[model samples]
Target: MAQNGTAESGATEERPALPLPRPVTVQEIRHTKVSERSTGARLCSCSSSVSSVRLQLCSFYKFGIKCQFRQKSKARTNTWCSPQMFIDNEWRTSSRGRTFPTFNPATGVKICDVQEADKEDVDQAVAAARAAQQRGSPWRGMDSSSRGRLLHRLADLLERDRLLLATLETLDTGKPFLQSFFVDLEGSIKTLRYYAGWADKIHGKSMPIDESFMCITKHEPVGVCGAIIPWNFPLLMFMWKIAPALSCGNTVVIKPAEQTPLTALHVGSLIKEAEFPPGVVNIVPGFGSTAGAAIASHKDIDKVAFTGSTEVGQLITEAAAKSNLKRVTLELGGKNPCIVFADCDLQMAVEEIQKGAFYNQGQCCTAASRVFVEETIYEEFVHRSIENAKKIVIGDPLDPQTSHGPQIDRQQFDKIMDLIESGKKEGARLEYGGRAVGEKSLFIQPTIFSSVKDHMRIASEEIFGPVQCIFSFKSQKEAIERANNSQYGLVSAVFTASMDRALSVSAALETGTVWINCYNALHTQTPFGGYKMSGNGRELGEYALAEYSEVKTVTIKLSETI
Candidate 1:
């Protein structure tokens, strides 16, 4: 194998040869902050003369040197603030006395330790949520308008601290900071406000009954809810579940993924600052087996909403059924297909495919992982995708210039490599980027494999990494067949000039969401979920609010005089 660059002595032999940047200093970052913002925010400015030059140097150094520099420099430490778990109106720790380390994926270093809740902790949280659902609980008795107002207040808090939240999310989840700021944070705020407006407006219709009777229906909270969030877009997923649930008067126990728990914990503080009653929202950060399983099977939980892998979703579903058959809503794995036709704008399609496959390091469930290109454009598309993939900057998430960062952790990084190996072994041609990047950080190159068959694991399974598998099809029927071959069907995209073709292909596709001429476009007002093994139920918009609520029917007899 040819090396792109040379590695320093003592660095891991498997480390990428790309130049590493120098260690960043807290003072330097503070200085950059002061210069960027005209405001006198009392930032401790670094003495470094050039920011880009320092970044380049930091990028080339070995992991050991980087760690040593971080220890010596204040700028490299974990300075972002995070809140503790709130339970029963009090901030507390796990009853079983356990904790888990939360790492910054940008550098694969522990930023802090979050309290790991055990079964006892899950029971306590459930009890607290159940109590909050009772008649006298602040959330239960509050008028709908008041609930809306509280939600709006939370939105305001989030808006005011948007920068803080975005930084923490990027640092923890390895997503680009700017992307998190504009897409994730802004989207979350808008989602909350949108649902807040519905707090007082959720109403059911009355139906005509027999001559002597009247029938009416109402929607009520499902009571206590258990929400299990995945690592990818942690804060945003939390908002997707919590906003509508709280808006509909449902108290919730949120279990954030073990990999990225800081932002969720911080949101707990925001909830308190918004003046929401303590038991109305609780966050428990722990391992999937301990906290997530307990939440899924808890008898007191009236409903369970989860976002994760299909395998995990299945386990949660079975557990929920075994335990009182609690209402379940799951948004699971997606092997979404992006179909490109000969007549489509090849440049636009290439860009969309690049973003769809590699955005957030391909951790998004709805990411376009499979590509079915008409035979005429297959070669060109594969070539262009490889060219674009090579240009993507892969390094520190904190760097605004970095387009792609590391994966969530070492395990995820290894899993992606294993799958890439599988693709190569299965006879798929490795077009580009089938290797890991930086030695210390869990960074994988944005990879692409062409000549992939429909049955290849890379094409059929969810790699959930920055890997794209390309296959060629001779006709639209073949494309549809290939797209629907996967058991998972969450979202898919089609790029074609023919409106009729787009419509026909979209209709034939089995995914719940089909985007034409675009990929990964989402809105808070639109309902999102998947069909088949992609899990059940819907989220976002008014539809998500319904998931947290139940229907109650009432009947009245007309007066005999009538």
Candidate 2:
């Protein structure tokens, strides 16, 4: 459990208020100079007894980083964090000297200005990665054990700075702070450590041919990989790409999603501190059109790994084909389904399904947007699901008691609302919650719609919000058919007690991954990806290593050698 009153199991809890900021006037506090950084930046710090709210500002001639500071009475909390791009193993601004601001989705306030990478910046990063991949370069020459040492060191640093990293992620992405810390950050640490252990363990194969010739296969690092990560799980997506690539001894240029780049930039600092050779890993913060496109189409990049929307995944794939024919792997969007049989534990199914549909504000690609229930228990399941949805706490992500936060920004908020409106127009019964919470933040009501038809937009389209659509199915065959009707094949879930049914349905589903009695369960040891329009390529486990490696076979004749 965290000292901030968070539960070990990541349940919401009540806690005392320490430093929630009150609406203030200018007279409340004035800025006081703290010190100057070597970068010619002045640090301004202020405090006030009028309220717990404080302000800290770092201003340079050409750059500035501003942050809001609050306190947990004795413990400190940072509201805004400094953001920078990591390239050539150094913190830098863009070549064009342009920056874009990112906001706290929970508060709808701009938190910090992030450096925006354009074409030139992407080119520089790609060139650096290519250089690092060259023979005799530090990263290329390093042994697998040495590479693993750096990754483990980086993991240790991440654990040491876990609180700060989680805070930054919560502030930037509007996910619950505890969830960010325990789930995203914890997953990242475990993933890095897991890949680190596999560094020296990656092996090739040997074969003897007809006793006269010897043949061997070697798995070498794929040169210069480009990874474009998504906003939903910024830090975790980052690790998902770089961890396996580095473990396979590949150099990388990563583009963190522009909306949530802070935590990735923070990890950038750790990468430098861990002393990874320059260009081994570079973090570029920019929009998908510019930085992301450059990565996907860059001729020098040998491989590209991306996690984003299905539309963008197609663009990346096309860009790869139009360029140097780079190897590509993508983990795209999902419109997942969760089928509940009458034999399921009623209470357990309701609770687990709620988490699947509402966790991370339902921004997860694998969220159970479409839930089909056995017709016999349809009424009970709907009522119980509504009850569970009502219990979900929605507020500021920093609050320990808040289980749900705002959507990423205005665009996503509008999209979710539009989908909700369409559901009503299409005649789905709104059981509860179908409006925006307030005018202030980007919060939506945890919505549930019953009597949904399989053909409705709310049922077929990926509504990446805290909205659940319930449909009734008469038989197991009907449930499977309805679930597989979508264009996506990312994931699906089944809540049933019968072992025979679990296996039968799980095998019949058209998804890349299936949960027999659970939902939203992800592990570092398991392979994860999508099928069909969902995406291409797997992300985790030993299978992921293949995406970042190239195999070459060599044959030798004993007589010829002599």
Candidate 3:
């Protein structure tokens, strides 16, 4: 390996490609936060098998850090302000002087207070974004190549601060520390680098026309962009909104979900460290009703991108239409499906479906909430799924060995418990694991319900928790129909050994994205969105760049034939 994260041949070592250097395991992370006192551990022996959840560990496993564990934990430390808003590359107290506390969901304790941005704070942020995007400003006048270089620098800063960012993420959201580090942190870094490569590549094309006339189409920035991110994957959503918008030469005023804002706040300081022009990116942490409403209705914000519930998505659309009719894109709620055929690889189906259903404690919008298994193998699949769910270790998120964590808060916990109760009332077979795990905190047992009917509330509604409902189908047509019979059309999976069955069923499905034999496989290189009421527009890939841009047609009449 090279010193600067570049590949070097003749080193005789094989490792996964990464933009930056990372430690071999969670134990190697030298920070003194959630994870306890570190002990000396051996270098990797190249025996750690790589998985989706261990993307960071795959890079240089030969340098082992030992089997990770905790001795004691200290107070939280960070590189940014908590009780102030980040605007114009500076941290400032809210003009309204109001502050709100963010909690550690795993412990049910308050982490710290954060500035609460309402309409006043949002106005200031919007003004800053507008100023930064003005024709003569540093951000607007900078060369596209320079813009790309800035994004690259930002990625580097994020990589350098990856440990702190992951700690903050787990501290605020109650996600397992390994998940915060290997999955969410790695995903965010990859997204930033991907968009950085695209910063200078966005271009317009000439049009064919008469010899005396010339025509061309240009993709221009949509000016100031307003982003309202969700709490489930705060840091990932934060980068998803800003990377493409910034690459397209647009300024952004982002309102991260108040429930989880620490990582976003830390990244705000990172934006400054990356040497981005002042006001190019602003972060205001507050409630959706206040800061979110202001951004949706602000005429100065040229476009808005939001990720949340379908109901909230509707409100944003209404607010946008009632104001300046600014362009908008939404990544919203989903009750996605997975169909397992009789001939499918039974073990793979169970594992992938469980992962899709339970990862992030099932807070994902693309969670595999609904599963339609062929009747012949439905009972066995359900058995294997319950066994797999039993392996999840639920406890303090800071414990690297813990695979499951608490719900975001009391409300989410209550909602999930209520849905489980509803499933029992609706006569679904409670196969295994229901109810809360521990007292005080918000940990819910990995729940599974078989013999689920399509009309059951647990089957129909977006539970947004680690609960899986399995429905059995008699035929291929029935399985496809049952999977398609939902208000949401976000993503779906079909598990079968036959390629013809995979292709045919994938094509017939009404979802935006389809997985052949896998589930929840997302890449920054591919676009992801929904088909029906799930929401409009896409995130990630070349498709996301379109959401932050405007197409203008230029035509000229030639003075004379050339």
Candidate 4:
């Protein structure tokens, strides 16, 4: 064994060296407004069982560092590195020194303990963000071009660490690594770069007024944004909220969902490396009741953005209203419907519909949960859908061949199973899988419920699992009506070759977005959100900028100017 770096002071003796430098734990981070304060207790330890030997201190040496050991399997492995909340600029624990274990849903293995942000931690993060937003602050004083440059640099860093980020995401969320790498990570990078370009382009407009006066309107950042992201697409959601908010010069206190915080914490390191000003971006991981509610209701927070269930979205809205009437942008639940007409290509519809409903294990908010097929092809669609469900590989997310992994956690898995049971009891035919595949983890079989009526719980409610509900209808008007029967209006799709029918159905569906012959087609250029209870405000495209901005009109009296 060879030493890789210089030894730290107080090393009594040199011993076998580690093949790689031990990674620094979050507890070692210290800087900025959230000041480092520990409870002076070693909450956890990472050590090997074998006879330990001290090695030279590596470049990554810090407090709470893990011990690396060689295994009998001829592989080097490190103990789990505990995650810490990133507030202001440093990584710290909750004020009470509390933490909760985050597990890999795929294996039901405790990956590491994540620092839980209590109200006190949330307050500190909010205060730091508020300070960053104050007048004359470095973040607020920076020029738009400079801001854009920083965002671009962050994007570059993200591109460089794409694989690592994807791996972390897969480990935390049970999403396929390929999907995390190709879709979520790529989307995050694109979102960062897209908003980076918009930083300098954020503009004001001049308007002609009366002869005596000149009028102009400018889009300014809403200060100290509190953003809460969902666990489904952890990194992607973080980028969606932060990119536009930071581009518009708003500081942010972000709360990544408790279930999936690894990738977000990893991104915090990149934020530090990007040289973002102190307190500009803070990442806090905790439950919705504590950190999330604190962010929404904090008096100093200017806005609150959430992406989650509609039930939680309502709570956030109420919290904002009770506080400062902070602006709220919510992208919530969906019971999205896909209408497959007889004129459409059968195989294409089958493939895309499967992707729509089962992508990410159907945890997507815009998943085409309900499918209304023309009666002529209803049987064929159901058969194909059942076959497709069977083909979905259920295994470790690390395997690229595994198309489906476990649900986010046990709670979600149980909820999905309950819903499948209800579908069966309600007289819907369970054409395919309807239960958990294995007891080891949270894996649920890809399920299909045919003859599902509009009123059934499985059809109306968002299972948010690998469950698809199929219904048959006669006419285009009937299909549209049936599709719009839900409170959710996030996204819907239509599979038809008829130009007129596609146009009419797309227009008729009460959804934020209607895709024709496609599903889950998202781009930074297109705006995405829900129309009704699904959520409020848009996410992608230029429309997202509005959620983070405030418009102020200024009028100048030409003759009255002193």
Cα lDDT over the full model 1: 0.81
After the best TM-score superposition of candidate 2, give how far the Cα of residue 197 lies from its true spot, in angstroms: 0.3
Best candidate, lDDT: 3
Clashes of 4: 0
Better of 3 and 4 by lDDT: 3
Please list all clashing residue pairs in model 2, or write none if there are none. none
Q: Write the per-residue lDDT of candidate 1 for residues 1-562, one digit (tens) a residue.
A: 3364445553445755765332223222212222322221111122233221111112112212231232234434422222345576455666876667777787766665666788888888888888889998778999999999998998897887676677678877889877788788888999889989999999988999788988999999999999999999999999999999988999999999888876777677567656687588888888899889999899899999999999999999999999989999999999999899999999999998889999999988988888899998888898888888878998777777888988888888888999999999999999888888766768888888999987788888789999998889998888898889889889999999999999998999999899999988899999999999999999998788879989999999888845
How high is the CA lDDT of each candidate model? 0.81, 0.83, 0.84, 0.83
- lDDT of candidate 2? 0.83
Q: Across residues 1-562, which tens digit of lDDT does each residue of candidate 3 receive?
A: 7786556864556667765323234433332222111210111112222111111222212222232322244422212233467888766677888888888888777766778898988999999999999999999999988998998898897887787678778878999988989899999999999999999999999988999899999999999999999999999999999999999999999999999987787677667657789889999999999999999999899999999999999999999999999988999889999999999999999999999999999999999999999999988999999999999999888777798999998999999999999999999999988889877769998899998998899999999999999999999988888888888999999999999989999999999999988888999999999988889999999999999889999999999996
Worst 10 residues of 4 by lDDT: 52-61
Tens-place lDDT digits, model 2, residues 1-562: 7777779878878777776322111111222232223121111122323231212222111111233333334433323334557777656667898889888787777766777999899999988888888999988999999999999999998887776677778878999888988899899999999999999999989996876799999999999999999899999999999999999999999999889987787677667667788888888999999999999999999999999889999999999999999999989889898989999998999898889998999999999898989999999999998888888888878777888999998999999999999999999999999989987669999999999998789988888899999999998998999899989999999999998999999999999999978888999999999998999899999999999999999998778643
Poorest stretch of ten by lDDT in candidate 1? 52-61
Model 4 CA RMSD to the hidden true structure, in angstroms: 10.6
- Backbone N/Cα/C clashes per model: 13, 0, 4, 0
In model 3, what lDDT does residue 314 have?
96
